[model samples]
Target: MKIGDPLNRSTDHGPQNHKAHLDKLLEFCQMGIKEGATLVYGGKQVQRPGFFFEPTVFTDVQDHMYIAKEESFGPIMIVSKFKTGEVDDVLRRANATEYGLASGVFTRDISKALYVSERLNAGTVFINTYNKTDVATPFGGFKQSGFGKDLGQEALNEYLKTKAVTIEY
Candidate 1:
């Protein structure tokens, strides 16, 4: 889907938040190219008004690639193919990141799915589905992704203070 004026209900998507963010996303795209990751799809600015950038996709990504290491926070997907039975290796690579906001595991094997969910450093792990969040569920990240959480009871705690009281009769 191409980016267009977000005000239009027909538009599937819109531009980045601002120019700086757009520039950063562009930089990541270039870094993906420079780091030898195969660009499978869009990687250029839309050349229109606002900070529009193409939704990008990169395949054959390496662990050391910038696209693989850092979070672009943009409409970019980096795919790293692994050996058929190398779940441990994949988990290690996924957890090696400094940011641990979210992760997803898609598999028919229940045991494998649970194992990956247990080992991933991200705070949220989606099995079989992606980006499924609810107001009742706490959402946040681990490591450098930031502290505390948002939504759910956990988020409510952030703005509340607990006080202990004792009564003697």
Candidate 2:
């Protein structure tokens, strides 16, 4: 993606939220290389004035790799191949994580997508899409990603303090 001016109306993407995040993205890119993942595309900074990192894609990523198991919050996509009918194994590997903020499943079969998304530990699951959310839908992570939400009714509940009460005769 193009790291252009954020204020520009036509800008597709912008710089990272922070320099530390950009540094971590660069570090993860290098870590992927050190861990034997093939750098398919874009692993360097944009060489611009801002903290902009290139969208990186790595192939041959293993489940045991640091980049695979760690919680990376940048534009990095790791590819691990599995057989067509091995959805169970894929789910196991996908759920084998301490942080579960979000996960994605791109499949033509609606039933399979529903089945897989339900089993994923992530709070947000995208079927045939990514990073797409609505204000009406609850958004939050299940594990170490976070405990609260930022949008919808779930976010409103964060401010609530309620307890159960009962009276019997």
Candidate 3:
């Protein structure tokens, strides 16, 4: 796909923030290929003047694969599959990763979504969406992703002070 411009109203995607990040994303895409993941789509830089990369997709990925485990911080989709009746097993595998910055879940079933989202070990869990966050909600990671929040009420609590007084009953 073409690199989208943020200023343009019709643009849906944009280039990577910098050259180094783009390079790193390419490396991870390549690593996924070498590690036996199937490159289903767009694993190369677009023929343009900016730090643009094709939104890459890797299928046939195992839960243990590095691409599935690490964050690319770029436009990359790593797909892994689980049996239909084994969602708990899938959640277990998803939470096995040490990093818990963000995670995405895509499903039509809201009940199933709530069920899976509750068990995910991430700071922010998105349903049928990614990279979209609300400023009024707590945002941070649970494990090695981070220690503190950057937005929402939890961040405000850091700057607030509350004291309780005991009353005779």
Candidate 4:
């Protein structure tokens, strides 16, 4: 697979949603570099007609870096390393963000997976996978990410109001 025109259908990659999103993605990539994070992969914008950014990856990301603390909402991944014994601190750093939308945990140990998932503040936590959403499950965010659900019975409940009536017989 190669990066080429998405319209070809065979191409493995596509452009960003728009120019603004592409620019934002580029900015975050630059910020990652400026903040001393190592750029492990692509970090350039393609010269094609539509807005496109190279899929990027950053290593040695710090908790305080803008690229680490904020969501890029683009095809960028930041890898932050933590000590094995610092699970508590890592959870705190992960939950410190204003957005509590979704999170993922990839681990072979079920106990560790459950432990972290239980502590993460995000509304959706995926174990051993990522971004697994279904119509059968309620979907929403906590904190500034947003409120209320959009699917499942929980979403249906939003428009319905329960009423009670009492009659003396």
lDDT of 4 by residue, 120-156 (tens): 9988888887656678899888888788888998899
Residue-level lDDT of model 2, residues 17-70, one tens digit each, is 999998898889889999899999988889979888887789999889998898
Model 2 scores a TM of: 0.84
lDDT for model 4: 0.83
lDDT of 1 by residue, 71-106 (tens): 987788777766658988888888888998887777
lDDT of each: 0.86, 0.85, 0.85, 0.83
Better of 1 and 4 by lDDT: 1
Model 4 scores a TM of: 0.75
Tens digits of per-residue lDDT for model 3 on 1-169? 4367867856657888999998999899989999999999998988888988898888899987889888887788777766659899999888988888887888888888889889999888898987676688888898888888989878987788899999999
Global Cα lDDT for candidate 2: 0.85
lDDT score for residue 144 of model 2: 88
Q: After superposition, how far is residue 155 of candidate 3 from its true place, in Å?
A: 3.8
Assess the local accuracy of residue 42 in candidate 1 as a C-alpha lDDT between 0 and 100: 91
Per-candidate Cα RMSD to the true structure, in Å, reads 2.9, 2.5, 3.7, 3.8
Off by over 4 Å in 1: 1-14, 165-169
Q: Which 10 successive residues of model 2 have the least lDDT summed?
A: 75-84
